[model samples]
Target: MNDGLNPAWLRAFVAVCDTGSFTRAAASLDLTQAAVSQQVQRLEAECGPLLIRRTRKASLTPAGVKVLAYARDMEEAHARLRLALADDDPHVGQISVASPGSIGLLLYPRLLALQAAHPGLSVSYRAAPTADIIAAVLASRAELGIVTHRPDDERLRTELFAHESLCLVVPAQMDDVSWPALVRLGYIDHPDGMDMGRRLLARVHPGQRIDQLPVRGFTNQIGAILDPVAHGIGFAVLPRFAVQAYPRRQAIRVVDTAPQVIDSLWLVTRAEWPLSASAAWALERLREHDWLAGADAPASWPAHDNG
Candidate 1:
């Protein structure tokens, strides 16, 4: 009859074969026996004789056996399609996010915990600078991004997600963070070190530029930026989250400043498309942290140990 098999006809045929009786199949399908018989006849019209023995008991021909397997496969595929379309479960999908190294240091563990809690969920976290994060979101490489500043692009929607304080870190043995003291210690610079240093140091050391400090060492790695500082080589400025994650944190001291210098962290996404269920779920989970609420005060340094 037609170019394609009618799903209704195949369903009725499969039901009849499974039940082994027309009356039982009709009851299972919630159809009259006459209606079920008509559907079976329609299937036979499309593919030639299917049922050779149709009495109180039904028997399948060779062609009917082959069609039955394919019909069952189609039913299974249809069920999977319905499940995929009804993607209401937020805890069972993939999410991709990009952020600066400092933010990543704080977020990666949380996302890992989320994935651990929901084994069906998967997370892809990329540690990148502001520019790279923007690029990744634009290119569709990442669905979510975290940046210190709100992006100016019309394509991106940004919301203030958190406030990250810039920290001036010195060696554990150091006590005084006077301008002259910092000058003697020099500056351990990283990619964002000079900028962060200038922003935070500007308040304390008025009229002094960050470049005025000698550059004792340089590292692009967020974790290693504090290494030289921890070893008593020089001082550096870093995000509080990055400072908190250092393995040798006790070796370095975070200098508490009056009128703390803080950077607004923005969550970014494409303006055109709404976030998927998984990404939205992840965003909510990330917002649950107290630090993300911008309530974190400057951390007090541990007492200096001369020994």
Candidate 2:
């Protein structure tokens, strides 16, 4: 019964709610703070005062909360409309995806090739942590999320993508060494390195008394972590995707002494909505793309253990 409630106003309100701050919402929407605030006020005038109160964070009044869901529904409907109509036009649809850095690196080139083929398809891609990727999908900010972990939430659906092998990498100049000797070499820790190191040691050394290994260097960036290790600063545990095509891969050797570890990749989306045609097309290509196509499986690659 709300007449003339502009879609722009609804969009602005949804942006603020999603970001939890007018300033951030304005930034995300590329609108000025005053413009965003004006849209909220305009929306409230049409709907009889939507926001109830404001403190450290924006809290939607009961009316605002009700409106929020409707607003998102409208937004999704509009996006799907564009996608459905875009099929005939080719250039009218947009596809957004969220993924982790290494997977993003692996797929970005392929995605570009896909885009080139479609000419009309536009892509919005972001690389973030696994949790953030899932949040993006749940919030409907991304049409798909390519992730390493399969979330257990009932609201999400997942499809298996691939299995990435994990291996221990050392400076090529370093000789084959034992656990304690490797520990003496120190560690170049990335975000996942510490946990991977702990597991690797447990699997290889069995009952070794080591509580923790010394950390020589640290970086969160996937590709950046390898340079220090290649320079002999320390050793690292990394996925094959991160190490295989590394520019300096030849400078580092993949150690085969440790048992092969594997990480599963998954494609996730909200269960509330079906995939748009554009999303489905891209997902098929992503699944079919040979991620490990040309790359040589390391000689030390171990067979899967049924136990």
Candidate 3:
């Protein structure tokens, strides 16, 4: 028997069985009677003789009965595939997103809330570094990505999503932000700690480099980076969102600096592909909140460059 049986042949064979005659089946299928008969003949040629009687009314042999069942199953499966492909409803599908740990802390809950409100929607969130976030978006693993810096790839579309201030988190007891005070407090490093410290500290401690400070502790976990600081172990530089979400908010203080070091957060997606309805809806929801509202920025502060 032929393995690659044509669907049209199966459709015609099933229609003949339904109408009980090739002439009536041809009328229902909008084809000539000879064409319908030829289709059924082609089906039988592929699957062996399927009809035992060729009278005004059709009769199915045992083989024909089995073929009819298989054809019906194939038709139902094709219908289901069509329905799935046609489902473009924004509220009825999954949306995957990835971002840095600081933003993920804020975003994951918001997405969960969205899922709660719309029970039909499902969410997948990932806390990742900038490079990993970009890779996820490019590989189509994530429909949306939040990165501290804009990606340079031509395949990606990036827009300024929000601004995150680099904050100096010190023990709540420490009021002094003087260079000597920070040096005496030492440093608690994380994945982005050294780079963020260099940027923010450069403004406050003009001549001092981050390496000059002794490393008291290190943790790559965003939530736990401030644990040592809370215990009065050392100071660390972190994004304002991460600092705000910390459970022990009273144990740490964000030191007020002369000029705040703000990092631009970019929303990235595939440039060539249109976003799914659910992904677009989620993106809009994410943009609704001012992520920096209570981060201690001056009302008159102008937006900084992407640098």
Candidate 4:
């Protein structure tokens, strides 16, 4: 916009589009919700045509969609400029990383160790889908990415680090690991959109009704799935790491079946750009994880190979 609108507002507008929630946008920009809303409003005032719809959740107005494409380009260019400047001065630099919530969650604890191992290293974290992580790291928006899937691009170096696999989580006293019982009781599904959960269900029971599970509730959040299951209400198919991290894990029992649901975890970085000391040190520390060093045999997770 040659209208001399603030670049900060433009950046905030783009983050809102990416996150689809003002609250998440606020978190992404490290700003208050009101602040983000005001920036968007300021941008809209310059446009004066209701750029954003501002629905109950989040929706882009017709004009909002039109501008988002270009806005994203601008935001990316700004990041590149910032990185170029930071490269000139090593004293102030940033490393942005994108990861799915599961592996992303575990990686941070290890990242803390990495940070402790090195001082004056600034790290930024973003929770994003697999494809976005691949794209971001490839584009140099992020120097490195901790993702579950491997990128096919030869320009990026990918290493299998740690894995978080699905384990059958049932109540501590519930000894019934029978498929029939699980089928009858309706598996408490965690709609995390992860492949392992779906694949394991297919392996154990093929040609079965997937939608109903007879009658079960679905939750996108892992905690929602684990809480009810841990209380003996129902069983859940979850990553071992997730089960172990559950608040009341002692009340639950893990059934790591022979054909485990394992998704390979990978570390990806652009080959063209050599990692800085901070990033290189972090990568080395990440490689030290014993869990990532080993791969679990998930019956059939061929689809995970695509990314």
For each candidate, the alpha-carbon lDDT, in order, equals 0.84, 0.78, 0.86, 0.69
User: Would you list the rank order by lDDT, best first?
Assistant: 3, 1, 2, 4
Candidates in order, TM-scores: namely 0.69, 0.65, 0.73, 0.61
- The residue pairs that clash in candidate 3, if any, are none
Backbone clashes counted, model 3:
0
The sequence of per-residue lDDT tens digits that candidate 4 reaches over residues 1-307 is 4656688888888888778888899999999999998998888887655444466456677777766776877878888787765665333356567777766656666766555655545678877777888889888788878776677788988887555666777778877777677766666765453345567666666655455455455677755677777666777777666665567768888875655556666788888867865566566666766645334444464423424
Name the lDDT of candidate 4: 0.69
Alpha-carbon error at 94 in model 1, in Å?
0.9
Task: List, residue by residue over 1-307, the lDDT tens digit for candidate 2.
Answer: 4655788999899998988888998999999999999999988887777775466578888889889999988888988777576664434466789987776767777777888898868888998878999899999899889787888888999877666766788999989657777879888888888777766666777775334668899999877889998888888887777786588878899887456566667788989877777777877776675675533345466533211
Error of 1 at 226 (Å): 1.2
Q: For candidate 1, what is the total of clashing residue pairs?
A: 0
Q: Give the Cα-based TM-score of candidate 2 against the true structure.
A: 0.65
Tens digits of per-residue lDDT for model 3, 8-32: 9998999999989988899999999
Whichever of 1 and 2 has more lDDT, that candidate is 1
Segments of candidate 1 deviating more than 4 angstroms: 1-85, 293-307
Mind sharing the TM-score for model 4? Answer: 0.61
Ranking the candidates on TM-score from highest down gives: 3, 1, 2, 4
Clashing pairs in 2: 91-120
